[model samples]
Target: MDFSDLNEALASESYDQIGEICDNLMLQAASEGVPFQDEWPYAVHLLGHIYVNDINSARFLWKKIPSGLKSSQPEISAAWKICQKLWTKDYGGVHESLREFDWSSQSQGIIIAFSERYRKRMFELLVSAYSTISIRDATVFLGMNEDDAINYAAVGGWTVEPNSGMLTVKKAAVAVEQKVDPGKLQRLTEYVFHLEH
Candidate 1:
């Protein structure tokens, strides 16, 4: 139950150990009557924002939020500021170009090229930023060990499975029957329990 111990466990990078640690942590939090369900929505929102390259805007808005107002009021003003900045910096010329140029006519003339490599790199950056907290402190906050926290993150589409030698939750889910497969549950349970011992 020690936060310091949990932090140490997470730093080890062993997925199984992490999962076990998170499972116990979650159980402990529940025993203390902490309401994790309430936090789930925010977590999902964070995931989506990260997936879509919105982390920078989110961070900018976070910084603009007044210390007192931030906690007491909604962050709509901060979000507005971020939107204004993004529009001015990135999309400012787009409207004018579209108006003056034959952008619409030319758009379909050739493939507007984009790099899969670049997109993947951007996704990695977003995932790295998202993992900074969720893969560590947020997991601790949620009372999960490293592995369970990582698993939950994967389930939420934050991380990709290894190219080989790992049974990803998605793969396991697809291989099973019923709403929640008992076999997969057992596998996860055994995995966590083994790490604890």
Candidate 2:
């Protein structure tokens, strides 16, 4: 129950900090000649990686887990299911896995936050990539039912065609101002002048 740094990170919803803390904890345990085995919350560590969409790190963590522990700990295996779905780009599968598994109280908050982030990210991708998308495809991408997808798209300022069931994606205009560093510019000019001379 005493998760130490992990509990602190979770309390602040600082998901990015979880990976570093878990890494340090593992290193500390190893240095102390302590057998971590299943004593550590491997599931939470794996989920932290997944929460940040760090699929490669999550996969690496999964590989590092002992087979015995992986088999014995249902939570660890369940967390890996989400990782596998994410790896395959199976968006619907990710939602399904999240729903199917009964996560512990400690892990539930991160899971919910991860789900919201994933959905928002997918919406941003849709806005940038599509002029129009079918309702069915949008549902799969958002991991929502048809009506829910339609409503969500509408809330995002997308127009849903009743007959066609195609959602018109509203792209937000992004104005990027190029910032030039004066010192860097002067240094570059000096280098160019020297080269020409």
Candidate 3:
């Protein structure tokens, strides 16, 4: 991976671009039979997962990380804790860490990658908390201003009652059945999702 470009992308918050770069690197690494001798690549892969809020993929990557590297790299350990906290619903702790993590600590990219993940969590909480909610209340819950809240409702295709700042969350679609994972060990991990795509 090109540290210069990667760092610039992190600073720019170009998450999709970061995902593309990291995914390509991973494909190349795999093609060359690269082993997990260090934490840098895994950290980049984890950052990509954070970019898209794919905790399942993140756990898969974390699982594949060799134990030596996981404990050896402070950044790797720290990033895994962020994932673990999110997985376990420790939002307050994750938020606190995110707030303090910065470039000066030498992990700004890892820090910022989770902003999207946290926002996604907020959206999920809003939807799951109630079948419907007032736009004003949603704004408070989502930390959005009124106009932005309205725009958000519109963008989500939510039903907004005329002249009432209320947004209704329709029953979201879900899989008819959950797939089973063949790997017993991975299936047993609490942080890992067992269902296949």
Candidate 4:
């Protein structure tokens, strides 16, 4: 399914339907005999970014008010509550690490250091989120095969052998493209959609 569609569903608060769709998607992946844990970090990190950045923006626009609005303002008051909770609880260290990293230089040391910190926290968030759902459910949510899921989870710099971490999403994507079947990835992507479509 498209990210926009998923975001729309989330905005509409159709969580139960979302859960069912995710469940079915996972079942399809399971049938392929792929494990699911690997992709968990990617999914969590993506979701965390969505909830924090995009959702917050939408909530702000929907509220139709400037920063002068009081906390009691109806527009974004509720949303701010949820966003604050997720930020403080779910993705606590990521923003901090991003600030700590020097983004100016394209040095190898800078890249490796940032990636190591980012991936570790991303993995931790993924594991925490995954524990809340069944393997079947997670597969559906990510729309990836069980194997792809595990591969994604097995991501992080430390998870791989030294000098093999790759250290960036672009690099990881290239590696997966080379190693994984394009057709399989497409199918997995499609599977993440709600069957109702």
Largest lDDT belongs to which candidate?
A: 2
Model 1 scores a C-alpha lDDT of 0.39
For model 3, the local distance difference test gives 0.66
Which stretches in model 2 have alpha-carbon errors above 4 Å?
Answer: 176-197
Expressed as tens digits, the lDDT of each residue in 6-113 for candidate 2 is 898999888877877897888888888887876888898998889878889888888899999999999999999999999999988998888898899988888888
- TM-score of every candidate: 0.19, 0.85, 0.52, 0.21
lDDT values of the candidates?
Answer: 0.39, 0.89, 0.66, 0.40
lDDT of 3 by residue, 70-185 (tens): 87765666667777776877655565545554433335655555565565567788777778888877775555577887677667667887676678876567769867776865
Off by over 4 Å in 3: 1-8, 34-36, 99-106, 116-124, 127-197
Measured over all alpha carbons after superposition, the RMSD of each candidate to the real structure, in angstroms, is 21.9, 7.0, 15.7, 22.4
lDDT of 1 by residue, 1-197 (tens): 34454445434422223324444555676799875542322222222232234656445434534455544533333233323433454332222222233222212111111112223343344444443343444333333455865665565465534443232222212355559789999999999999999
Say which candidate scores most in TM-score.
Answer: 2
Q: Compare candidates 3 and 4 on TM-score and give the better one.
A: 3
TM-score of 3: 0.52
Cα misplacement distance, residue 92 of candidate 3 (Å): 1.9
Order of candidate numbers by TM-score, starting with the best: 2, 3, 4, 1
Q: Give one digit per residue, the lDDT tens place, for model 4 in 52-169.
A: 3444543433353344443433323433443453455534333333334333221222233433444455555455443333333333333345555346645532132234322122
